[model samples]
Target chain A: MKLKRTIRQVFAIAKTDFLGIVRNKTAIFFTLLFPLFFLIIIGFTFGTQGTGETSRIQVGTVNLDGNMIDVNGTVSQNSTIGDVFVQVLKDANFTVYEYDVYGDKDTNGTAAYDISRGEIKIAVVLPANFTETLSYQYTDSLGIPIPTRAHLDLYTDPSDPTGSIIGQQSLLGFISGFIKYYQEIAINQLPENLQDYAEVLADPITVSTSEADVSGRQLRWIDYMVPGTLGLVLLWSGLNHASVAIATERTKGTFQRMVIAPVSSITVLAGKFISSLAIVYISAVIMLASGLLLFQVNLYWNVPAIILAIFLGALSAIGIGLIISSIAKNEEAANSIAVLISVPLQFFIGAFFPLDIMPEPAQIFGEALPFTKLVYAMQDIMTKNLPFEAVMPEIIYLTISGLILFVVGIIAYRLSLKRL
Target chain B: MNLNDIEIDAVTKRFEDTVAVDNVSMKVAKGELFGLLGPNGAGKSTLTKMLCGMVNPTSGTIKVGGYNIRDNAMKVKELLGVVPQDIVLYDYMNARENLAFFGKLYGLSGGKLRDRIEELLKFTQLDEKAVKRHISTYSGGMKRRVNIAAALLHEPQVMLLDEPNAGLDPGNRLALWEIIQTLHKEGKTIVLTTHMMDEAEELSDQVAIMDKGKIIALGSPRQLIKKVKMENTITVVPNKITPKLMEAVKKISGVKRSYRAYDEEEKIETIKIITERAEDILPEVVSGISSVGSKILSVQLSRGTLEDVFILLTGRSLREEEQL
Candidate 1:
């Protein structure tokens, strides 16, 4: 009879609380819209990689080189080898803007100014002797022709970190290819016996690259971020919402009414947990749906595993919220403290960035956070397409930690009941 | 045999350094409409909460329906219906929804819960349209009625109403008084706490006047007035009340006490002459004041009431205590 009554009371409380949240505009905004806002913003910002869509990087080029002879000693009327190199950059997915270099003026400075103004991500300067040196040849004592080396300078914008790295890499790769093309032409002009030695000397140690098969499909930045975004949604729905629940009730005088009822405090808390768990799942669904529909994120659905992970993650998040609610004197204080804890917690738990790139101590701290484990478990199941067994350790950690924190939360709630 | 429905023995509640409910003992008989009368913060609400098992007494025992609150708190709670001072219902939910939610918490369900909710909605005189509207949109009186209705879903034997008529206009207070009287007529024991002296005198079968965490006087309103031997008051509002006029009134035969009292609400001063029979002393008092060169504007004779009883017992007006 007691167990039946407890179940009935819990459901009653959950039903009322859920209805209250549905009707409350502020609650609806935080639970559904806030996290969706983050997902959409982050998704559009970094979701172009695996979708076969590429945005061109803008680069400023300063060509001081005069029209000089090519390797065949023929001069072009309108363009030099520096123009050919600029054409190579355009072909390699760069929007190149050419900066004119007058007699001894600083043309590199002009390129740098465009970079600072956000018009370009990188600046490239070609020396006046660029084509002359590449075409210059001399006979050694043994009467063998030797080529002179050419130099190029690149200045990258520090503000756009990712763009700077991509610009630098692409420019370097193009220059290497250009040098190899000229080397092949030079080698072909040599005698047959010496040509093989020249070919070997010019390109000694060729390197080839291929992407590793992680999940049978290429993963984009959106795919990696979807799970982290889900964790963030849970943090707000479970932690922030739960933190203010009891304080709001106290302020509204409902807490005293509940206490006066012939119901245990733990039973009331269980009802609150059930309502918050429902909210967590609703928020998670909205996040996943937005990711799949808006960004076309390629992730394994893994419904049962995802449900289990969210349930456990909500336990930890709500548990921490209960602790905060117990400590705060009122609803406003509870809300302020929850935001103070949750904002920094998102970064620390790798909800927005990868923890592996952080320092050792920070990585350890992230590893210890329950939300981080949820993010990792989600990444494994969604990105890696791993089975349940692959994430069993994370599941076990979440379950144990969630249970421990929930127990502590119950104790704190009971203490708060006494104060009330 | 315990004849009382509620018994509080040497109950005290302290918070840190302050004592909210000092060591006190009282018994409320079965089916009695008991009033806890005091100004704000006189520990009436604290004592009511202790009886409801919402607050634990620092010492002693409270028994409701023969169940000790310390050992059988749930049993005590099961027998009591609590209507808190603040409006405790979810403002976003309609009246029926709020009632149904609380009904389920009391272990009522299915047809029984539905029937109880319907009965309460009808009993509170909330129409279908009113029942469908959210509590936040309801008037203060309507919300107070629903607040009381939520506590009645379980049909508890004892009802605790902490200032149920507080902040209500005279019409609403009369309506609530009718509800309380109806409940009392059904033989349900009730403990009502309020700072309003007239509410206590009008509704209580017995009244306990508490002050500084202690019960200063306890009995029926008439019994208390008689026990205190309070004198009838003859109020004379003259064109002007002077110290010499008040002294002359005090020297009149049959006059026991005379003092000039200011009416805060009326913004006027009057001289009150306390005597055994106000009718016999009224003419003499009026003449005494007029002989002292004071022109009589009005003269009235009235019997001592609960406020007079409170003033006689504590030498402080109930209204004065409210200001403090």
Candidate 2:
């Protein structure tokens, strides 16, 4: 009978609190719409395509090649190799811009300026002697012919890290293709006996590449970010909301009423926890649904693991929130403090970025956060499609840390009750 | 000889260097309507909180419903209903919803909870439309009514109402008094704390006047007034009250006690002279003020009451202390 009463009391409080949130417009905005707003903004910005057709990468070209050719021993304009190279780049799905079209005289300076202004991802400068070098042929003392090599200068924007890598790789692939075409022509011009030696000399070594099988599905940036976004949603709904629950009640004079009731303080805290957990789950679900529908983020749906990770993550966040609530003097103060802590914590926990790219100290700190553990576990289950046992370490860490912090939160709540 | 419903012995509560309830001892018998009257910050609410287990006494014991609060807090809590000074109901919920929520916390459920909610809403005299509207939209009096209704959900034996009529208008205050009297008639022991002396005198079976965390006087209203041997009080409003005029008023032969107070609303100073007979002192008191060159605006005589009792014990008017 006693346990039954306690359960009833917890549910009663939870029901009332949940109803209070639903009725309050400000609460509804923060609890449901705010996180979805964030997901929409981020999803559209990064998750535009996944293994499908993509927009062309913008490239700026400063073609200074004179187009000089050794035709019958007279150097005149015959074949324009620079124009051919530019056409090659455009054929490879690059939106190429020539320096002369922009009326720029200095080649290197024009390329650097365009890259800085974000007008182009990368710049290619074909040197003035490019064709001349390719046309030059020499004979050693043994009377053997050799072709001169030409160098193409490629400049990538460092600020745009991902775009720079893709731009450089694409440019290099096209350049290799251009060289092979010229190599075949040169070799065909030689005698049949020298053709075999020239073909071997042209390409002595090669590299073969294949992608490692991770999930057997092509993943996009949005796929990697979906779990992190869910963690972020949980942080706001769980920690930010819970931090103000007790303080708001105290300000409204309801905390004293609850304290004077037959219910224990722990029971009241448990009720608040249940309410916060429900909100966290609701926000997480809405965020995931939005991601799936809007961005078409392809992720493994491990329902049980996802549920467990969210529960543990929300538990830890609410534990921290309770501690803040106990220390805050009023609802406004609690809200300010929660935001001050949560804003920086999102970055530190790798919710917006990856920990591996962060500094070592930051990586260490991020790896220790409970939300980071949740993100990691989610990534493994969703992005990598790992089995349940693969995320056990993260699950264990969250369980232990969540339980410890929650116990401390209860102690703080009890102390606050005494102060009241 | 009724059994005591509440017993507080040597209870003291301190915050830092200030003592809120200092060595206070009192007993409230079952079915008794007890009033704790004092100025603001006079420790009445602190003592009431101690009785309901919302606050712990620093150095003593409190027992409610025959259970020691320190040892069996939950048991004591189960037997008492607390109506805090502030309106504590959720603003977004209507009367029925708020009552149902609190009812469940006290272990009521199903048909019982529903029936009690309906009964309380009607008993509080709320109209059907008012009952259905959200508490945020209700008038102050309606909100106070619901605040009291929430406390009575479990029908506990003891109810603690701390300044329930603090901000109510006179009409609403009278309505609240009627509700409280009805509750008392049903044999529920109640402890009401207020700084309004008339409110204490009009409603209490017994009144305890507190000051500086101590109960200076305790008795029924008539008994306390008679115990102090107070007689009629003559109040004289003067155009200007100077120190010399106050001294002359006090020197009158029939004057037992004299104090000057400012009427905030009237924007005038008044001298109150407590005496065995107001008629005997009225002529001399007016002449005394006139001799000091202070013009007398008006004069009135009234019988002694609880405010007189508080003035006799503390030499300060309850209303004056509250203003200060």
Candidate 3:
């Protein structure tokens, strides 16, 4: 009879608190509205990676080389190494703006002006010795002197770091392609006897690469960010709402009345936890539905595991909120403290960036936080489609931390009642 | 054996360095309306909190309905309804919803819970407006009534109200007193704390006056008055001050204390005489002033009130302790 009464009282309090929160229109609106903003903002910003106008990069080039004289002693327009270099960059889909070798000052000045004005990202300058060095690679047979290496100067705007990086990559690709073309042509111009040595120099080390996905379908950035935004919605909605609700009750003396009532302390805490858990689930559903309809994010993978992850995540978040409520003196302090804990973890926990790419100590700190594991567990369930056994470590750790915080929170709540 | 009697033994509660309740001991009988009278910081609320098991005494024990508040706190809570000094009801919930929520906590449910909520709404006279309005929209008197109904939902034998009438106007105080009287007639033990002296005199079968965390005086109102040798005073404002009139008024029967003072601010000369019965002695006081060829401008007679008893015991009025 006693146990049955406790359950009834717990549910009674839970029902009242749940109705209080859901009926609060401001709470209902912000819970869905704020995360939808994250979905549209973070999703579209990082989501569309290789589509439309965003993927194009502009490059500028200036060749000072006059012309190339073939071993037949003819000026071959196609045989000039500078001409082959520009053709290779053009083949890779770079819009190359070519400048004259010995023209008036206006020719090279305009290219430099475009680079500085951020009109172009990369500037390639080939000197007069561009083909003269290549013509000497065939001269060892004649005992004539040959230049050892050719220098290709690359320039980019110092202030435009992102453009500078892309332009530098295009310049490097052009250099790599010109080396192969010069080697093949030089060996072909030589007799058949030295061609094997030229082939060995041109293709010194053979490297191969391969990439495959587990589902055979490429996951978009929206797939990864949706789960993170869901975790974020859970953290903010559960922690802030629960802490403020408990603190408001304390200030209003309603919490004292409940503490002094015939119900047990666990009943009061359980009621708060259950209500926050329901609100979190509602918040998660809204975020997920918005992802599906608005961004075409997939939700067909591991539905049960997603639900479980959300439940455990809400459990841990609300447990922390209970601790905040127990220690805080008022609603404002509780809100400030909850936000202080949740905002920093959002960045460090691989929600916005990968944790492995960060420094080692920062990675360790991110791993130590319970939110990091929750985000990982969410990714495993929602994005990776991992099974229960695969994600058990995170679930177990979250459950243990949640239980500890919940036990401590109940004790603290009871102690606060005595003071009140 | 009175089932609803509450026994508190040597209870002391300390919050860090400050002692809130200091070794207080009291026993209230069953079916008695006991009033705890004290100034604001006199430990009355803390002592009642200990009895309700909301606060733990630093030293000593309390028992209600034959159950120890320390070990059987839940059982004790089941036997008492507590109306805290603060309005502890949920303002976001309507009167009916608030009462229903608290009622379910005490193990009432289904049709029984619904019926009890309706009965309490009507009993507290809140049925008419509670249907569509939240408690936040209710007036102070209406909220107090609902607060009482929420406590009485379980119908415990003992009801503890910590100054239920503290903030109410005169009409609301009278209306709430009528409810207390109705509950007392139903044989429920009721204990309340208040600074209002007349409330103790009008509503209490027994009263305990507390000061500085200790009970300075405890007894029925009449018994306390008789023990303190209570006196009433009669004051007369004469046109001029004279020694003969002061000497004559001091000789009145049962006149114990007298003094004469000239007010410079009001430019009035006044004579006051304290006696056992001011009603009997007032005629002589006025006649004595008239015989001196001094016309009495105004004459006033005051009875022995609880404030008089408090001043005689503590040497301070209730207002002084509250200010301190």
* CAPRI docking class of candidate 2: medium
| Steric clash count of candidate 1 | 0
- C-alpha TM-scores of all predictions: 0.91, 0.91, 0.79
Question: Which regions of candidate 2 are displaced past 4 Å?
Answer: A49-56, A66-79, A101-116, A135-204, B264-268
Q: Candidate 2: what lDDT?
A: 0.85
Across B277-298, the per-residue lDDT of candidate 2 in tens digits comes to 8887688887888898989889
Best by DockQ: 2
In candidate 1, the residue pairs with backbone N, CA or C atoms under 3 Å apart (3 or more residues apart, or in different chains) clash, namely none
> Which of candidates 2 and 3 is the stronger one according to DockQ?
2
Q: What share of the true interface contacts does each candidate keep?
A: 0.84, 0.92, 0.76
lDDT of each: 0.85, 0.85, 0.78
Q: What is the TM-score of chain A alone in each candidate?
A: 0.89, 0.87, 0.75
The DockQ-derived docking category for candidate 1 is medium
CA lDDT for candidate 1: 0.85
Error of 3 at A239 (Å): 3.3
